[model samples]
Target: MDRRTLWSNGAVAHISLQDEVTAERFTDGEVRRVTYPPLASLCKSPMGNRDREILWGQSFNVLETDKGWAFGYALRDGYAGYIEAQMLAPVEAQATHRITVRQTMALSVPDLKATKAEHVALSLGSEVCVTDTDDKWATVMGAPHTLYIPASHLTPLNDKEADPVAVAERLLGTPYVWGGNSAFGIDCSGLVQIACHACGIACPGDSDQQMAQLGETLDPGTPLQRGDLLFWKGHVGWVSDPDTLLHANAHSMSVVHEPLQAAIQRIAAQGDPVLRYARLTRL
Candidate 1:
């Protein structure tokens, strides 16, 4: 069981794992939705290293709560980690739309020009339940109140982008955060996951999981093309073309497009060579 997806904490575990894992306590967890956005970090330990992020309105299965932290897995990708308890709330409504823009504000009123309106920033991939809509704005349910956001920033939950690469291209310059998944910042695997999700593909949260579970491996000398996945020991990227690689890289501290051959050489020099080339069945 990968610890990142496993619901156990040595002493307790989700009831679903009872047949395979030992624990002192097993219980069915409660589901809750993230109330804060731009992004909320899910840390390996309470306030420790971030392992992933749960976007606003995304559901989390809460297995345990201690002090002010909730330990659970993100319902979207099953990545388990600790999140600040206050950042989540009881699910009041199912999500009806997904935020399509990089970022947008949920305002106190429908009018964008309202100077004193209270607002909260929402990020791309965040889900919202729109109760009402006009030509320019949507009224969505907030944690404790109703909020309005631009209608143009949202898409129906069932809609998907046709090309995953195009979804990633829109985030070309986002900062490379170690475990970030939002447009504000993202890692290599996070970028791939986000892009895949937009195209209605199921993806694992970590690079290793994605490499092992996402797609079929290609032959050693397979010709690269758009949307092909390239994996290194601890990193991953998308093939933008036969000659270009697109990824959120620590070396650059941002997502970028680089010559594929040059990237291969650069990464190899650091003792991590390209490990595999994969092509997804759906794309």
Candidate 2:
């Protein structure tokens, strides 16, 4: 079959099997084939964070049938497991374009003549996919990343455009909440994890998980820029520029951009020096 990209970032579908099959699932692992990419935080079960998570790079081989794709998937870190076909989504890749602004600006519905009517509150340099552009808002198919602008602020990259830097900015001002992954709330590590996910990159859920996955660390004095994943022992965040970090800090209660020096000092006061033993994940 010809290869294609699936746009359903977090959508799910079911498969019907003609014969019973084995499920060799693993957690923190990946699928064997690239037939389709699973959405971030996608769960096979509707239960609370307990469903079989089809992490990035993971796949399940099924018997080709006249009806549709059918088979079980190996989930839970490639551990011993098997789930029904009724829990997955049938997806294929579609073309997408990523856009970055020439200057610091906000995203809004293109239809609105003024900012107040259409402002979507996106951060400057934020990365967004343009599925279709009208006069104002750009329609991003998969996860609703439609950003509105004056049609003059954006510079559209081709389909398959991936900008991790602009992706980091979209999470600004998200509140600091434990286990919260959506824009409504997020933690330092959660911020980095989700940003990577949006950019079609795989990252673990916690700081330690992320640290273990990505090898080595970068020198802080080297200057962290946009899309650089910043780590500090138990916490992680993304850098929007050389001097500012985007993250959800306890003090702020939401995602915010802070000077590197100030963030270091603040975390250090908590006995967790932000720079003392920090790591960097470059995607």
Candidate 3:
């Protein structure tokens, strides 16, 4: 089993894995929601390297808790990791809206001009429960009090962007962060996941998993097109056009649009040539 998705930690595992794996204990995990915003790092081990990130209002199934860390898998992508236990809370309400922009401020009051208004930056894909709404602001139940966000920045949970590439383009210039999943910082796979999720397409969290599970592979020599996925050994990028590639790359340390041929040549020179060319079934 893939350790990233498996709910086992030698001592215990989720009850769902009882039939397939051996463990000293198994129990049905409790569900929780991420209460922190901007983004929450999901670490590979307690205080270890971040394997991925979870946005506000996203669900995490907690199978174990140790010290101050919660060990579980994210419901959005089944990526398992450790998260700060205090950053999560019981699911009090279902998310009604998802942030549509790259980032937006959630103010302490409904008016944007309030001088002392406290604010929190919410990133794209963060979800919230809209309890009240006026023409300009939306009231959401925040940790300590109700917060107001711009009505124009949110969309109903069921709504989705029409173009994944267009969604990806909005995050151009985000700093490259290992295992990051927000507009503030992101990795290549994170960029693809955020864009695909915005378009209502389910996607895996890592590049290899994304390569194995997403889109059908194109035959060798297939011409690249808009929305096509190009995979290198450990990296991936979206083809914005026949000649342009969009990705969050370590070489640039940010998400950027660059000449596709130039990227291919540059990456190949580093010994990681293009591994796969794929086209999504839906777009």
Better of 2 and 3 by lDDT: 3
What TM-score against the true fold does each predicted structure earn? 0.97, 0.48, 0.98
Task: Note the Cα lDDT for every prediction shown.
Answer: 0.91, 0.46, 0.92
Error of 1 at 94 (Å): 0.4
Check candidate 3 and list the clashing pairs.
Answer: none
Per-residue lDDT over 1-283 for candidate 1, one digit per residue giving the tens place of the 0 to 100 score: 6789889887779998999899888989899999975568899988899999989998999998999999888988888889999999998889999988878899988877889989988878899999999899999999778999999999998999988888898888999999889888999999999989988999999899999998889999989879999999989999999999999999999999999999999999999999899998898
lDDT by residue (tens digit), candidate 3, 1-283:
7889888887778898888999888988899999886678998889998889999888999988889999888999889889999999998889999998999999998877898989999988899999999999999989868999999999999988888999999899999999989988999999999999999899999999999989989999888789999998889999999999999999999999999999999999999899999999888
State each model's C-alpha RMSD to the native: 1.2, 10.1, 1.0
> In model 3, what lDDT does residue 26 have?
95
Of 1 and 3, which scores higher on TM-score? Answer: 3
lDDT for each residue of candidate 2 in 48-113, tens digit (9 for 90 to 100): 242223332234432221123332333312212232333333334332332333222334444554
Q: Which ten residues in a row have the lowest lDDT in candidate 3?
A: 3-12
After superposition, which runs of candidate 3 have C-alpha atoms over 4 Å from their true positions? none
Provide the lowest-lDDT 10-residue window in model 1.
Answer: 36-45
Ranking by TM-score: 3, 1, 2
In TM-score terms, which candidate is top? 3
